[model samples]
Target: MTGEVLWAPSAEGRQPHDRVVLVLDRGELRYRDQRKLQGIWVARGDDVGRIQGRQGPDALDIGAAELRDLLCRRRGELKPALMDQALVAGLGNLLVDEILWQARIDPRRAAASLTDAEHARLHRGLRRVLSVSVREGCVPQRPGWLTSVRARDDAACPRCGRSLERRQTGGRSSYACPHCQRPP
Candidate 1:
């Protein structure tokens, strides 16, 4: 809430049936996201509790064994598995791609198929990615990194300097380096 919003509408957006859910704690915060087809309903105390209950441990605290267990719980590709908050929280699409790329693991590989070495690399990558994200705030403090190229139209692998591959994974545009993160 302290940082300025880089991108947002000039004013609040609303349409028919759009109503402010609540000024949380009376004039604390309001539901201000742009409304489209479905109205965005703000969460109350109970709703917040339920949602947080579904969230797993933060990326920083999860041990290698715990991470391995979470990965094994899903038979799906690594991208989707990483995106699951119920497994381990705080991983988004960008973070997942960055983590896999940093760990030198293929995004399409099955989560259950990861070897012990791969898991170790993944754990390190997760910590590094989360640390960098928290520190730099997604502003790309330096060049030649995953987040730096992931959003570019002519993105290439920062480490290998090879053309990056982009494809659909779990309904999101997943990025990977063909040279660094070889496909299975």
Candidate 2:
């Protein structure tokens, strides 16, 4: 229940300046960057109860069943819905992209439109991608991995060697293998 708070100031025009405070309990993370006043809530501790962020309901001390029920009610885009920390916690853009690719689901797919099979795929993919990424501390780039091209403007698909396409999605650069993730 006792932990230390870490603070970092934002640079000019950086808004809240990448400040994250970790609340630790018994040497495990209980809360992370609880900057609700500044509209930032990174993650919550597994043992913590009822977490509140600046955006409200950022994460409640709820069980897995509650979290599943909440996810089922979202009708928004699948990526953003998964990224909503208030709903699932501990997922971001890189994770989302990697999950979708592993699940073979398009990023633009509507959450409600996904079939049960696709949902299963998404869940499995999310877990797998996150588990490995967390161990490695963020997605590491392999020579031919898609992530290698993620930040390269003219990078091509590693699988097919075709030019990768980029678009502004959810206010971030979205890199996709056009051939592999064709529109439905």
Candidate 3:
């Protein structure tokens, strides 16, 4: 996706430069805050396969079964496992936490060890969260959303009313409810 920022010139005011920020997950494109950036990532057959939701005939365009199969192939923790685009494309770190919390599945659980029912829950959660994100825009800032209460001093889980606990997962700070999302 392309992001264009409009700003007045230095002569007009002390405003930042107008620029286009192009961000590709995992693969770095240093436009937002970088001086120099270069990469040769062609969105061809092979590269399309690497990106999860690239509108190809791969995992992105497939149904829940394909998505489940893609995720189950990874043996890592759920957080990192979901974020790896090569495995299952569209989910980022925040989405990972959001999906896991919605599914009541612990982010620390092993991906390959999840029961069929748990997998079903995770899949349903993905559909619910992702579609809501697409429709409402920006991850849905409504009640029962972790992001809505994540930064508050008294952030609590919307589902169980328990305090939302912060923990490091895959080098990122993630918030979840311990009582709801017990480790599996």
Name the runs in model 2 displaced over 4 angstroms: 1-48, 52-72
**In model 3, where is the ten-residue run with the lowest total lDDT?**
28-37
lDDT score, candidate 3, position 163: 90
Q: Whole-model Cα lDDT per candidate?
A: 0.73, 0.61, 0.69
Residue lDDT tens for model 1, 52-133 = 7777887768999999998887888888888878778877777787889889999889989888889999999888888877
lDDT of 2 at 109: 72
What residue pairs clash in candidate 2, if any at all? 10-17, 30-45, 36-54, 50-61, 58-86
Compared with the true structure, what per-residue lDDT tens digits does model 2 show for residues 12-125? 232342244333443322223323333443466852343343222322233434444666788877778777776676666677776777677777777667766676776776
Residue pairs with clashing backbones, model 3:
52-89
Q: Tell me the tens digit of each residue's lDDT in model 3 across 13-88.
A: 3223222333344332223322222243548776765643533233235577876776678788887777775566
Candidate 1 to native Cα RMSD, angstroms: 5.0
C-alpha TM-score for every candidate: 0.73, 0.63, 0.71
Q: Give the TM-score of candidate 1.
A: 0.73
RMSD of each: 5.0, 7.9, 6.6
TM-score of 3: 0.71
Best by lDDT: 1
